[model samples]
Target: MKVIRIAAALLIGPDGRTLLVRKRGTQAFMQPGGKIDAGESAAVALVRELNEELGLIVDPTEAQFLGEFSAIAANEPGFEVNCQLYRLDVAQDVMPAAEIEEVVWVDAGGTDELHLAPLTRDSILPLYRSLQSA
Candidate 1:
C-alpha cells in the first residue's frame, strides 16, 4: 500500500470544539494541515499549511507535538496517510482559502453524520476523547 505522509493540526478552540475542514470536492472533513515538504519539519509544514488553507498564522513553536498516526485515506482507496499530528490552543477565526471549500468547528462526536478521514475517525478522535476524559 502506498502511504502519503502529512503533518496535521488538531486545532481546538476555547470552546472545546476542534476545527475540521473539507477540501473542495472531497466529502471527508479532516484535520487542517497538509503534506510535509522535503527538508521541512512537521511543525514547519503545519505552519505553512495553516497559512495556505485557513489563512491563519501559527508560529511553528506554538504547536504542541502530539505524535504520529496512520489510517486509510478517506478519499483515496489504496493510499494511506501517515500523519505527524500536533495540537494548538487557538481561536483565530478561519475562512476557507486555497483548496478549502468549507469549514466546521465541531466536537469530536459531533461529526458522525459527516464523512471523516480515517485518520480523524480512527486515531485522532480517540486521542481527543482521551484528552477530554482526563
Candidate 2:
C-alpha cells in the first residue's frame, strides 16, 4: 500500500465558518488543501495548495500549525493519507477557482451534513469543536 502525504488548511472566516471544497467527481467535502510535493515543507505545500485550489493567497505568518493525522484515503483505494493541518484566517468573500466543484462553509456542529474526508472528520473537526468552545 502506498502512503500519501498531504497538507490542508482549516480556513476560518470571521463568521466562524470553515472553508470546505468538494473536488471534481468526489462526494466528500474536505478542507481546502492537497498533496505535498516532494521536498516541499508541509506549510509551503499548504500555502501552494490553497492558492491553486481556492485562489486564496495565504500568508505563511498567518498559518498556525494544528497537527498531523492519518487515515484511509478518501478517494483512493489501497492507500492511506497522512495529513498536516493548519488553521488560518480567511476572507469571507473568497471563491474557489481550480479543480474544486463547489465550496461550502461549514461549522463544527454542521459537519454531519457534509460528507467529509477522513482526516477532516477525524482531526480537523475536533479542533473546530475546541475552538468553538474556547
Candidate 3:
C-alpha cells in the first residue's frame, strides 16, 4: 500500500469550532491541508496550504505541533495517509479557494452529520475532543 505524507491543520475559531474542508468533487471532508513538498518542513507546508486552499495567512511559528497520525486514505483506495498535524487558533475570516470547494466549522458533537476522511473521523477528531477535555 502507498502512503501519502501530508501536513494538516486543526484550525479552531474563536467560537471553538474546528474547520474542515472538502475538495472539489470529493465527498469526504477532511482537514484543510495538503501534501508536503520536497525539502519543506511540515509547518511550512501547512502554512502554504492554508493560504492556497482557504485564503488564510498563517505564520509557521503560530501553529502548535500535534504529532503524527496514520489512517486509511479518505479518498484513495488501498492507500494510507501519514499526517503531521498541527493546531492553530485563528480569528480571521477565510474563503474557500484552490481545490477546496466547501468549508465548515464543526463542533465536537456535530461531526456525525457529515462524511469525514478516515484520518479525521478515526484519529484527528477523537484526539481533538480528548485535548478539549484536558
Going through the candidates in the order shown, the clash numbers are: 0, 0, 0
Q: Model 2: per-residue lDDT, tens digit, 17-132?
A: 88888989999888888899999999999989888877787887778988888888889988999888889997747667788899988887887777888878887788788998
Stretch of 10 with least lDDT, candidate 1:
107-116
Model 1: which residue pairs collide? none
Better of 1 and 2 by lDDT: 1
Give the Cα error of residue 132 in candidate 3, in Å: 1.8
What TM-score would you give candidate 2 relative to the actual structure? Answer: 0.93
The residue ranges of model 3 lying beyond 4 angstroms of the native Cα positions read none
lDDT of 3 by residue, 1-134 (tens): 99999999999999989999999999999999999999999999999999999889999999999999999998889999999999999999999999999999998888999999999999999988887778
Q: Give per-model CA RMSD.
A: 1.0, 1.2, 0.7
Candidate 3 global CA lDDT score:
0.94
Whose lDDT is greatest here?
Answer: 3
* lDDT on C-alpha atoms for all candidate structures: 0.91, 0.85, 0.94
| 47: Cα error in model 2, Å | 1.0
Clashing pairs in 3: none
Alpha-carbon runs more than 4 Å astray in model 1: none
On a 0 to 100 scale, what is the lDDT of residue 71 in model 3? Answer: 95
Candidate 1 residue lDDT tens string, 1-134: 99988999999999998989999999999999999999998999999999999989988899999999998988889999999999998878897899999899888578878888889988998898788778
